[model samples]
Target: MASGASDCHFHGNAVATQATVSTCAAKYQKDLIASGKIAKSWAAVKEPASFEQIDGEKGKEWKVTFKDPAAADKSKESLYMFFTAQGNFIAANHTGK
Candidate 1:
């Protein structure tokens, strides 16, 4: 489980992989989750299915305007996902476990 300001990795469809998450950016990483690019969703068959909000234009779009470790920049390479909240996988993006 990745934490603030650090770096973490979340497996998504073939579109994204860090080879390790540390090198990734926070914005891109959260995008994967919020955009429903997770690996679990890639599978055609499964015991259960899941999805991400992507914060539709009608609703609220996810933003990273403010955060701890203030050092986190939106321009980072986030190509993975992490848990932004507990038990809530959709919004969760890679944080650096």
Candidate 2:
């Protein structure tokens, strides 16, 4: 993952072709895993899914924030995914240290 800073894009569901988990964020998580950004172990880190509306470069977008399992240090990390209301993957970020 591109640690620390956040990056955004306007992508589509076709770009998210690696969904292995069952959560709503699976597609986004799968993309991270496929790109070797996040570890495969993170596939187990699925919980605390929240929804929100954000102002995207194009317009408003739907964003989902999923909390990963605690790290070895007991610190929590989060995966933020932005998508269209139709469930297309737009962008994602893996935030943790």
Winning candidate number (TM-score): 2
Error of 2 at 80 (Å): 0.4
Lowest-scoring 10 consecutive residues by lDDT in candidate 2? 13-22
Residue-wise C-alpha lDDT for candidate 1, range 1-97, written one tens digit per residue: 4442333333323222222222233344444546666432222221112223234334422222212222245432232233321211233333422
Superposed on all Cα atoms, the candidates' RMSDs to the truth, in angstroms, are 16.1, 9.1
Which residue ranges in model 1 land beyond 4 Å of their true spot?
1-24, 39-97
Q: What is the lDDT of residue 20 in candidate 1?
A: 27
Q: Give the CA lDDT, 0 to 100, for residue 86 in model 2.
A: 41
lDDT score for candidate 2 against the true structure: 0.55
Position 53, candidate 2: lDDT = 63
Error of 2 at 3 (Å): 32
lDDT of model 1 at residue 71? 25
Per-residue lDDT tens digits for candidate 2, residues 1-97, read: 3321122333334222113122446656767888888667677865536777667777666677777555453243676777654445567765411
